[model samples]
Target: MFRTFVSGLILLLPLIITLAVVAWLGQFIIDYVGPSSIVGHALTTIGFSFSASQIVAYVIGLIVFLAVVYLLGLAVESRLRSHLSQFLDSTMRRIPVIGNLYDLIQRFVALMDKNDVEGLKSMSPVWCFFGGLDGAATLALLPTPEPIMVGDKAYHAVLVPSAPLPVGGCLIYVPAEWVQQADVGVDKLVSIYVSMGVTSPLKIPPLPGPGPRKGNLTAT
Candidate 1:
């Protein structure tokens, strides 16, 4: 009976833990800056009370954060963002431990925002093809170039990411011809990768081939 209970818990633990953490964070924020009784009393005498307006501040903060993000996205395209990011990065790099953490976070955010077609084009799937059949493989993009000289044949570099997670991986430079485009959208490919290949898009069946006519010979 204990073993069975443990097995069931193991199955549902991740989802339960996720919800618990979300709830805790929400409550923590709400309690930390929520209106106090004194503020509530002052507002109440002045036509508002903490009990009546406690949620207003939290709601405003959330709205402001979202609005800022939306406005930044509208105003700044990749080129602009890249320039701004470089400036910020340079400033951050001057700091100590914070600089390293900032750079790591910046790289993560850049990878996550690869929805732009130009950015998406740089990322290609690393296929493991054999005899006209291609199965499990990884996708990657070239964020930086590395110069390589193999027996006097010099070449640039490419970054190859492991499957399921692009951020955790290495960089290697294969010949340009070897890296072929998968022609898949970055969003869809990310979904497939995150789900570990379970979430594939629906395939369309080919049109039927021409078949010999059976009836209607009388008209001919």
Candidate 2:
């Protein structure tokens, strides 16, 4: 019975949280945009009670907000809008304190964007080993296979992003031989990190044994 209850809670937790957020948003809109607004006044004049009019106004505001977002999304797809976006971003980056905040927000937004996440995942994923010979492995996105030359030495650039919150992380430069490209998808790696290892794979399939053929070790 305890196990069953736990399973049930796990199944319903996401739905419950989503409903809670929606309810909170509805109440917030009602309090700010519903009461004494034009829509509420119009509804009240049309025979709705004052309280009922406020509720109706809240719904209207939500609908308008969604419609605006849809329209904005359509606008963003245009070439002119794309350039305008770049210009806006550049302008924002010039601000002092706001620049850092904007950069963090931009990274967070890019990480959350489905297309961007998918694209990063589609590129090769790797387990980066840091701290030289004795090192800890970290999941990272392998953006390039070519080693960066610093003086006469070469180093691999690995993107190690934080999990539970994918907004912040570091780009580490490590010895090329220490980085092991993982045979895993971006989604799997993300899930593991976001869940803080709660959703780690039961078994990581064994990497291939020594085999013939294949030239340089290239990215997928």
Candidate 3:
């Protein structure tokens, strides 16, 4: 009896979550278009002064917002606007702490944008071993090919994401030989990480490089 109840709950959980999300979104729209909201007041000023229905207000406001966003996207694609955007971006990056935060956020957003053809598609998934410890390997993304040169030696820059939340983690430069490509897609790796290894592969693949190095894998 207990087993049956558990199974039933598992089956219905997704549906329940979906409905809850829909309900919350509906309530949010209603509130956003309520009498006291900025959109509501704007609508009144634009000769929609007689419409008291929240639904009507919500539909109109949502349409207006979407249209504005669409137009802005089109404007950004224009050559003049594109150059202006680049200039603005460069100006923002000249700031102190805010510049650093902006860079981090930009990288994270680019990583999450699947539709971005030239974004993270360039990143390679890899299993990185620090100190040559086979058991202490971390899944990471190699975002660039340019190696960090130290005198004659070159080290690869890698980002090791925190499980369940890839946005937060360490950025380390390691020898290219210490990092081997992981046999998994970016989206799949994200799922496994977010699941805390629960959805991990049954068997991990071997590292791509040749035989192991004789000495420990040092960062320098």
Candidate 4:
């Protein structure tokens, strides 16, 4: 009987945990969108016009949340998005320490958003040699196609993300020859970083020559 009970309990664990999660989510929704809360009351009021049931009011609140998000996505394509984004950035930047964190998080999120074709596509994975071709080779990301000017010399913007959380990193401006664009996709590179070097390319070609060390990179 003890053995049977243990087996039954083990079998039910998954279902129990799943139910617990669903219950927690439902409570969270009620706490945030229930009639007692400010936003909840507003949503409930909007929902009441369509249905008398309070349950329906909560459902309508979620619908409103999704609708607002959809509208915001559409707004991204409009000219007003620039002004709105600038205003938002300026407002957040006024908060001192947290403001800088917010800005970093925003850029990191933009870099990770694969659906954002223009923003995310511009950043490509590359390998950077710290002191030049002879220095240590580090897998990094190039945020732009063109090189940025550092005095008279041109430098490629290299973002070397830390292991595990690619959220925080140092941006290095390296000379053209120091940066060699990686053949791997952003997703693959991110996986390798997130896995702490556990996941890696099966084979990577050896670093090429100390050919043209001067001037911008010419098309090969």
Best by TM-score: 3
> For residues 1-220, what per-residue lDDT tens digits would candidate 1 score against the true structure?
9999999999999899779867976776556544454533333344322224535644554455568888888657655876775687799988999997776556544556755444444434333222223333344553433335567554334555545565555656554333333445556656776665778657623312321122201100
Stretches > 4 Å off in candidate 1: 1-86, 92-108, 114-137, 144-149, 152-156, 201-220
lDDT of 3 by residue, 84-106 (tens): 66786798899999988886667
Cα lDDT computed for each candidate against the true fold: 0.51, 0.66, 0.70, 0.76
TM per candidate comes to: 0.39, 0.51, 0.54, 0.51
lDDT of 3 at 176: 61
User: Candidate 2, which segments miss by more than 4 Å at Cα?
Assistant: 1-71, 77-112, 116-118, 121-123, 131-135, 208-220
Question: How far out, in Å, is residue 14 in model 3?
Answer: 12
Identify the leading candidate in terms of lDDT. 4
Query: What does the lDDT read for residue 127 in candidate 3?
Result: 76
On residues 1-220, what C-alpha lDDT tens digit does candidate 2 reach at each position? Answer: 9999999999999999879867976876676556466655554454343235556655565566678778878877766666867788899999999997886566545545566653453346776656643577777876667777778766777777786555457778877766666878766777887776889888887644431122224566
Which pairs in model 1 have colliding backbones?
40-50, 43-48, 44-48
**Can you write out model 4's per-residue Cα lDDT over 1-220, one digit (the tens) per residue?**
9999999999999899779867976887678656777777887777787788987975787698789989987897787788878899899989989898886667667767776665566577788887877788888877665776778777787789997667667888888778876777788888888877979977897655562344434321
How much RMSD separates candidate 1 from the native structure? 15.1
